[model samples]
Target chain A: MTGELAIKNLHVQIEGKEIIRGLDLYVKQGEIHAIMGPNGSGKSTLALTLMGHPKYQVTQGTISYKGQDLLALSPDERARAGLFLAFQYPFEVSGVPLSRFLLQAVKARAPETKAQSNGRPVRRPLGQFRKLLHEKMEILKVDKSFAGRYLNEGFSGGEKKRVEVLQMLVLQPEIAILDETDSGLDIDSVKIVAQGVNSLRGPEFGALVITHYQRILNYLKPDFVHVMVKGRLVKSGGSELAEELEERGYDWILQEVGAASTESAEEKGADPDERS
Target chain B: MSDHEEHLGERKSQGVAIAEKPQREGFERDYNKYDFRDPEQYAFKAEKGISRELVEKISAMKGEPRWMLEKRLEGLEIFLSKPTPTWGGDLSELNYDEMCYYIKPTGEESRSWDEVPDKIKETFDKLGIPEAERKFLAGAGAQYESEAVYHNLKEEWAKQGVIFMDSDSGLQQYPEVFQKYWGTVIPAADNKFAALNTAFWSGGSFVYIPEGVEVNIPLQAYFRINAENMGQFERTLIIADKGSKVHYLEGCTAPTYSSRSLHSGVIELIVNEGAQMRYTTIQNWSTNMYNLVTQRALVYQDASMEWVDANLGSHLTMKYPSVYLLGKGARGEILSVAYAGAGQHQDTGGKAIHAAPYTTSRITSKSISKDGGRASYRGLVKVVQGATGVKSNVMCDALLLDERSRSDTYPYIEVDEDSATIGHEATVGKVGEDQIFYLMSRGLSESEALSMIVLGFMEPFTRELPMEYAIEFNRLIQLEMSGSVG
Candidate 1:
């Protein structure tokens, strides 16, 4: 189907070793999709490849966003083209306060304001930006102090994950790729994060939520659930697929696909790079 | 075939070759803004070299007292005897006799901008000194080459027994005060550069605040070097008397030249009993400069002194602003920031000498090195014997932008007293690929992301500056970061 992100036969690698052998997925606006997989699977590879990460080499693939070839765009261009990624491990940027970073990011995406006279981007009025940031912080149950803190410098695991979602909320991209955003968070934080994602749900917004558990899906209620195994989507179904996988585990699906033996071998010899 | 004459020939050829080459468009634009040089207009230019005769000529020109002239001769002797420093940065390339010791840009200092010569005034106008003074400064002075061409103080501050003017005028008008405190904090014999400055010093600021008075606004002085092969030796002395407060700022810039120049300044401060003083310096010399400055402050009982220094755009710089806590319950704080781009080396830090009981001091330094540049933090903290209850902490952080850049920390701590407390911490970090990628994914260009990270790194130092200076500092950082990204 035509979608905001349409990946077809995508092959990706890192450091000369293939991680995503071949993958195909489509995420349309006005829809939410979740990809669940066991350890050693290439869930993060797909997310990073979608964002044009330099380390993730796409050997053979076609990713079209809004009918434009996404591979040709730089990472920043992809972001400016209404694409966002919530990293599983967000990097720490020391000294940059969260509010200031958000403001810069917002200005980078929005059209140049009329007040810009010197060719430098004029920031949104401080009062208006502060009001919006505080409102978003409140929605995520984040404390006010978070706005003044260095980005992810000394933040707790839950805070980092929440802040990733918070950035998505402030930036308000058309499509988001959440890479294991709920892995280390508590149940309450999981609910809050999901609620934050839900706030941006509309006909103009779509999301590809990558997670290991079906817990966040319970609150997200994605339109489709896909099972990713050995760097490819093995199956796609409704939300029940996640619940079924949660109860039965991936062993049943592995046996059904007749790749259980290879899966076990790869799992035993899992490339450490995939986990990071 | 003396070393000085040989180097002068080589420098002339190199300058011609550089002028012949095609300039990069972007760099030319940036360079022309600060590197434009007017014709070499000078009232007098000292002969290239430093000798007893030259020192006597400088003294004779200034018409100094017999004692002062004798001091200059002594400084000249000491400067000749001492060897050039070997550590910190490379100073072997410097030729003592290749530099013009002094260039008197104007015959007399002007109290009003209108009276200043049009050529010199144009330079200051381009540097925005007058505008800054009109907006926020309590007093302002502009120095060209070797002389202060313009100096003015607000009438209100002048009415409160505040003395602000160029150092030459200060010596002439307040010889008693100058004689009492001159060279006390940083004696000429302390270092080779200090001795050189003492021997041939020209334009700098001299400020004094009376007891129980406060100058809430900053007094600023801007120094500009106009001619190639010029050496600027500015001597500044500030006295904040008992129960007084004052803040003074100095900024320096020089036109870009293919041949190297020298800037050796000596700044001495006296924070008297129960007084407070802050001295801020933002030195952005051209990349062809060797900036060696000695700055020190003496803190009396219950007094406070602070040094906020930022160094940028020099081929090599060695400066360590020091504080001597000389009385009980005195405090000293130093905040230093350095940025080293391509072909630059910023060897800068702070020194704290706790000599009295209950004295406390803190030094925080942040440096950024990029594009094959080197930044070194060389610091010293010494607490003498019997200085009980003395406390000091030194924290240094360095950020290297690429693999080619380098950072080093050399912290020397000497505590003779067992009762003193001291702590030193240093961290060196590179701009991580993950950090850059994360910022880039948020729609910032690579350079923009890098500059943002650097600006954030320098926040502690910038936040302490006045609002306008903070803005200007950020803009300078952004300009330095542009074209740095590969």
Candidate 2:
């Protein structure tokens, strides 16, 4: 029941409305899992809940990361523990520079990497940080001038998503949840983003790519595919499952769930509107 | 003038009270060392309340001419007749009967730093005046309490026929030029505060730049308030003669106090034909002071004037520096920035009046409010009936750091001429949770993000300041932001 990022019977509510009802998901290390669902299926809720957004209340759930209770930690603490979320809609900060924000984030991730001076935090020695940032930026195909601009302010849709992937790459988190990152990108940008996400595939990094379409899955080739309907995972399979859903739609999955409930209901499976 | 140019160490050897004192050891620019407090120390202080008797006594104390005394009496009558302003911040807390109109800290005004008392010199030193003058040094003036403790112009400028001295000395030494333009720019009945300042004004700079002369370095003035309840009313007048140019910088700092103080100053500037003048003020008053200052300038044909005003600290400040473009091809610009934090209210803006054809003006106002503070921008632009081809633009941007903070904008534009072009844009925004989340996800706390945003909001104003002042302005904003957020 427990894995790298294990969620058991997770129930999340926002403003007295239950968004994620009894959803369970498990993503182990070094594996990429795809959560594909239609709109309002609570796909983004799972992403936000896992990262500990204050607005998302986990009424009944247990989320553990590396055998530690992840639900109790703050967002930043969770991030420091190697958890990242590539936001669906990244916010903009008009005044802060991108390079400065990254340097601080990098310092937060690995405080020991920064060289200290006489009893003070010596800002990570700009030359070294800039070199490392330039390397990561080049790997992601980001413009060098992006570091000088304000964070996410006046950035194009693709540019914003690219910057998110770039942040995940620079932070090098143990696990990353990309919530609908491919929703607002073109075909070429999706492949490029998938390529950027794929480059981080190794024995140490894990990712959960939350998307509405299986187009990005073609490039990512996720090890596992999940269909979340009405706040619960209805079915899950290999990458071929993504191709099948790409051909068909959620109506077939709802009919199958209806037949299964008519015969005998699964206690863990969420009934679409039975509770209401 | 030569007496003030002596070395400070030699001045110490002259058996002066300050000469015997030693320099502070290991001075590391500790800004929190505002620990010097004199509960009640004054050689001469006028009693509380302003009356005809008080005005006559002040004029007699200075031994002024009959005409000047009569002018002070007329100013006092006008001040008593006008009511307190009800449009801006609250004025009900002001108790004029308990406030001291004048408090002379030292026995006499001194042109030399060595002749200044140790208490006043130490105050200016803590505020970083001596080192500032040494670094810049076109000229420097220092005022403590109700008197100009020290005034000095560099020999290079003093020999170039540049007149820079205290206003009181200016009135006595150069009567012809000083009398011609004393009340010409801003009359006594301009406002209630201006009328009050005209009656009790003391210890401000008087600068007159000659024709075709350009002062490369800025002339600096420093003002400090030492005792409580000392209603500081300094009057500054600057005149740039025809075809001249000058830049003036003034900085003010006061010790924090539990009791309230009042600072009402009047500044009038005259820019003659083809002249240019820029006056920059960085007012860092203590939180217990109510700074109500009136500053204006009159621009002649082919002239330009600029007001760079930055207000960082005050309990309630109501200042609207104005410019009157009275000649063809005259231009004016006012860049005003203010910050209000923790029980403070900064009601400040700018005004431009076009009275001639082909005149142009611009007003850029920026304000930040935090921790229950309130900042408002009240501006006005007017064009006369025959003042054709006039163009004016007013822009105000206010940032609130917390939900409890408040901001307001009031802009008035009147164009009697059909050929006038006027534009205004106003915006108010709070520190949203989205902004905080964005920065925090990047590992910054809430206050650090707010500080950077505040600095960016005031970038236009900060960039106009000299490099040193701009850096200091950013630091001050950082300090205020730390206290207000996160």
Candidate 3:
């Protein structure tokens, strides 16, 4: 129960349209969970909702982190409570250097006791912070120039994903939600990102990786693999489940779970009569 | 000028004494560091009005030369004849007769901090001026109200024939040199505000660097306005002789008052052949002040001039620092940043004029508006005829924090030369919701996220400032960004 993120019967909506319907998940401190789903399965929605995005309206759910009500906290509060999210489509914030942003985030995440008497967060010494940053960048194989460049501005898709992981390593959150971070990465880049994540693997770090393909799981080696369809998990298993899905597509699992794969049917032109 | 007498009567009936009551509002809360006012104490305070008699008295009080007195009278005539410009922020509410034209805080200037009056010295101590001077400044000058209370140059620089003192002292000590270069770059007929400044100018830095002398450290001047309904007109003139190099910095602040105040200043610089000059200003007036200023420089052959200006506070500000390249291969650069919060309108930019062949210049402006504030960039780039091989670029970027805020760009480019190269770019953007959410997800508060974005937008300007100033400017931006989120 300690250092655990528990979501029970979670339902989320966007603009009065239901997205996630009755999704339940529990991630402990020392576990790595992978959610594999096709397009439009509410994978990214779950990630955003977990981070308390303004756009995602939670209709019914109870999210508890470390025995506290996470729903009552703000997005920044949730982050300071040891949660992180690597966005599926990271927004480019021009003008802010990556190192400067990381330093602010690290300061904001410090405990209240570390704050000064004026109730302002005390900044970490520049030399110490730079040392930590350089070490993390080296682990992610990021060039030195990346630290001084504007955050995510003009960065390639692969660079963006690596920086996301790079941020996670620096922040060292207890639970990180990676939302399709490997969607647009090459095989080599995927391995580098996985290595960056693996460097943080321990009894104190947990990750919920959302992906459509099994390519990244080959390197991440998650402890649990759950097949998500339509909004909720349908089948939960081990690494072999991922290999099975890679060998044969999600059609067999969709039929076994009795849920129609709307995306696949639409692609194959088999759902002409169905209205979206 | 005749109509001001009627308004002066109305201002008295409204009880002008209450203007010094120090009304604390939400806007003034964040500016507490600069909002603390000292008790009004002055050796001589001019009556609240401006006229021929008042201008003559100001010139006579300084015991200036006959030519300077005649110049002041002529400036007064021009100022009274010119109608208020309607193109910039509203100046209809500015009352000339309701403001004290001059207030002499101390009888004489002191070369050491200990000799300064205790009250004025305490004010500068609170502002951290003396400590800053001891740390890195080559020389420092402090002006309180309409007089320079303290001014001193390090003996090393002073021994090298480098002159750094108040403009009044410059005229009295080096009359020949001051007379030779005074009003040469920016004349009284340049604009209405310049004319007003020329008529009532009192305390500003006059710096002169001898030929072949390089003052590696910067000379700084601090200006403070204390009384209510006070108009401060400081005139600064800097001359860098051939093969000389120097950097000058100025900062201004005022205490919060109920009634409006006016600050109109003129700064002129002459960079001789192969000389280098950099002038920086950080103007942070109170929210109840109207800041209208004119600053220009004349660069000679193979000379360079750079202007780094940042405007953070004022109810309305209209300023455009310009550089005129008058000789071949002259270089000019201007970097400006403006931040406008609630009840503020900042109309600021830069101008570059190429008057000779093979001159190059660049102008970069960045502005941020939040909470119904409005910021506009009004700039000009002119290349005259026969000024061939001239290259110039202008860039303006504005960031609006909310839907209620506004930003505009008015870029005027006039190119008469056929062989000139000119480039202009402007962008207006809002702080994206996605960007805020992304930063917030990484453990930063909303205000912190917004301030980071703004500081980033101003990196080009901050990078040109000294390390201490960059830190102070960042702190000021952070203060402005705090409690900005609703």
Candidate 1 RMSD computed on C-alpha atoms after optimal superposition onto the true structure: 7.0
Question: Model 3 scores what on Cα lDDT?
Answer: 0.79
Best by TM-score: 3
Superposed model 3: Cα runs more than 4 Å off:
A117-123, A264-276, B1-38, B107-153, B223-231, B252-260, B484-486
Q: Write the per-residue lDDT of candidate 3 for residues A1-276, one digit (tens) a residue.
A: 449999999998877767788999999988899998666777778899999999888999899999999999989999999999997777888768899899889888986536666534455678998999999999889998999999999999889999999999999999999988998898888999999999999999999998877989999898999988867888998888999999998989989989876576433232111111
Q: Interface RMSD for candidate number 3?
A: 0.9
- Ten residues in a row with the worst lDDT in model 3 chain A? A267-276
How do the candidates rank by lDDT, highest first?
1, 3, 2
Q: Model 3 over residues B180-266: C-alpha lDDT tens digits?
A: 999888888888888898898888888999998999878766422222112388889999999899999887432222223788888
Instruction: Give the distance in Å from residue A37's predicted Cα in candidate 2 to where it truly belongs.
Output: 1.9
Docking class of 3: medium
In candidate 1, what are the lDDT values of residues A47-142, reduced to their tens digit? 888998888889997999989999999889999999999999899887799998998898888866425566344666889989989899999999
The lDDT per prediction is: 0.80, 0.75, 0.79
TM-score of 3: 0.87
Q: What are the per-residue Cα lDDT tens digits for candidate 2 across B24-44?
A: 121111212322233444567
- The digit string of per-residue lDDT tens for model 2 on A232-259 reads 8889999998998889976688687762
Q: DockQ of every model listed?
A: 0.77, 0.30, 0.78
